[model samples]
Target: MVAPTIQPSLPRVSPWALSSFWFGSAFHWLLLLLILMPADIERLVGSAHKGTYLGLLSGLGAVVALVLPPLVGSYSDRVGKRITFIRWGVAANVAGLLVMGFGLRAGFNVYLLGFLLVQFGNNFATAPYSALIPEYVAPAQRGRYSGVMGLLQLSGQLLGGVVGALVGTAVVPRELAFVLVAVVLGLSALVTILRVPEPPRQELPADTAPRLGWLQLFAQNAFFWVFVTRALFSLGQYSVQPFLQYYLHDVIGRFRLFGLNLGNAVTASSVMLLAIIVGGVASTLLAGQLSDRLGRKPVIFFAGSVMAAAAILLLFGPPFGGVLLLALVFGLGFGAFTSVDWALGSDAMPSRRSFGRDMGIWHVAFVAPQLAQTPQGRLLDWGNALQPNLGYTLVFGIAAAFFLLGVVLVQRVKNLK
Candidate 1:
């Protein structure tokens, strides 16, 4: 019998590049929680149609996130440079933040426009940046690097929670917080420009087209299934995230923490976020390393199970202690999922030559959940109308269902072992 050909491994990337990439990831997560979540909540707080408005903004963002990434990523592939897109995207994000800050101060409609711009800028940066992983890291080492990225992302989330807590306690102006987030994003861009040199471009075929249509590219692709799994998992994970502050404040009611007078919803939500960060950081590090050895499927299955259980616990478990435990559990699952899922997707790439385009296509998984967020939000509102805090219960149940569905669907992936 003929033996299967063995592929040679790519060279390992430098520490500087890895660190810069991690920093960039960290900054991205930090800004997402620190600026976007709080700003959105602020916009919708007193509105009579809070759920509808939040859903509309989220849907608009989903649209931007869906459309821009693949197009920009394909463009980057054609040009053979991801860094330029990253730079411009970061700049655009900063401009969006400024617009958001001013718009928030002025009116809700203005802020909605700014929010859309932010989504465009963020998706543009992320799609190309994600493609860099395959470009820079060897396949064998993708998990380890993904773990490091996840750890940094959790750390950023932890810090963002702390900042949010401070803001909740009136220690920082929300406008100043937005400015700080923009500055951090700018600094991260600088680091990327300085330390993370773009990989040499793959020479395309002589007759290669500049862009492949999405439908053509997606047909018969196993990565599309990976994309579906990710969308379901993210939908479950994010179901509560956007509205968590309100849930804690409005449903759970104010309660003392650590004998200090921190009873506000934002503070409570931040505390829970901190718990999640701690749990996630540890699991992410371990899961990433383990996936490198055991393959991505097992880690993802385990993580998804844990996440589903956590969501269930949050719905029926005890109040304070249960909440804390559930947060930790959720974090553990989220961290593991975050670490392995990227590696899993990377393993399923259709072509290396079109990494940017393909990765952009993969990113639609993450953005597609935003489309559901509106309906989910309306669901929550509907539940609340029937009974107090019932909306949150419905949301958690739906989230659990999504997580379990993801767990089941991930088993269908036949490409990765």
Candidate 2:
């Protein structure tokens, strides 16, 4: 009983290898969610009904994102070919992005199908892809990896914001922007496919084979807590996200700088998002490293609390400048949370052999909030009808509550730092 053998570690990840794929992922998604989708829906259905239609689209598409990942991940676990799944997913996603772009004038049904396809493809790739993290990095180094992930993720958001402001104002490209989205997204995945090799499956030395049902395999207490915590966080974020453009227009009024028209909602929203991203970028890497030294729980708790406070402040209908400052505050908290988000689930994974499947179950948390989009949208409509911007107040109030609860519940997650 003298000394334990040290396992050889995976090579350190290059920053490019770690970040490029995620940056592309964030870029396309933000382009769609924040700018394109809203503008398109408004154009098709008009501003009066934009919120409801957007909610309908998001909620419907969310079904695919919610269901596909867990099942696909389990299949990937069995097949041991995560890269193949990723390739297929990318192909489908790119095709869907093209359909959405080119089919802009083709009515809502075509747009809906395109979005559904994108959702399916994105969730399909991400589930199996997420397992790569725990496989490639040592536990101690994960915070650094997450930090890098957050930084690149925010950077992509900044680019998406720029593109959206430029092209998304009219629901696109005209088609070049949409094509650009498909291109950039596909190219990013290609980078990872070419440069980052998938790690070989890690199997337990002394395996005990036992028959367990699908839910039983992944339904541990820690998993349950983590799922609830994550779902709550996503709930908070999405509550405001789908409505930000509208908020900038309705509540703050369209912005202008130096006696120049900033082109209504898109430009103002982009400016707000830029501020947010700046704050998030500044804090992301630092937070990730901090979590490594200080424990994930403390960092996440503090960040969530900050976000909750910011959301609460949004209820007042602050002026444009004040809103940008609040966005900055919110972004700082957002960066810290996202920095460690993957590692959060990775740490609490119940089955090493079934990492893909378990992680996919956790991925459901991200999509669960999408289910609320429609209901919340309807609520916004109703509240606004009752008394102007009352809907926003309710939506933000609930979001703040969700944020606080999500952060607090993490304290209950056993066996996680």
Give the alpha carbon lDDT tens digit for every residue of 1-417 in model 1.
322111123355553455464564455555454345544655556634566567767877899988888888777777777787888888887888788765666777778777777787778888888787776777798898888777777776777777766763367677776776777768766776777766664444444333346676666356767888999998986686777766766666754655566666666777888888889987988999999998888988888899999888776636654687789988899999988776777787766667788898888888878887788778888888889879889998899899989888888887676
TM-score of each: 0.90, 0.93
Q: Report the lDDT of model 2 for residue 161.
A: 80
Highest-lDDT candidate: 2
Displacement of the residue 46 alpha carbon in candidate 2, Å: 1.5
The number of clashing residue pairs in each candidate reads: 0, 0
How big is the positional error of residue 32 in model 2, measured in Å on the Cα after superposition? 0.3
Query: Against the unseen true structure, what C-alpha lDDT does each candidate score?
Result: 0.74, 0.83
Clashing pairs in 1: none
Report the C-alpha lDDT of model 2 over 152-267, residue by residue, as the tens digit: 89999998887877783465555778887888888888887777776554444344233245677546777788889889999999898999999888888858655666778887
Model 1 bad stretches (over 4 Å): 1-12, 15-48, 168-170, 202-213
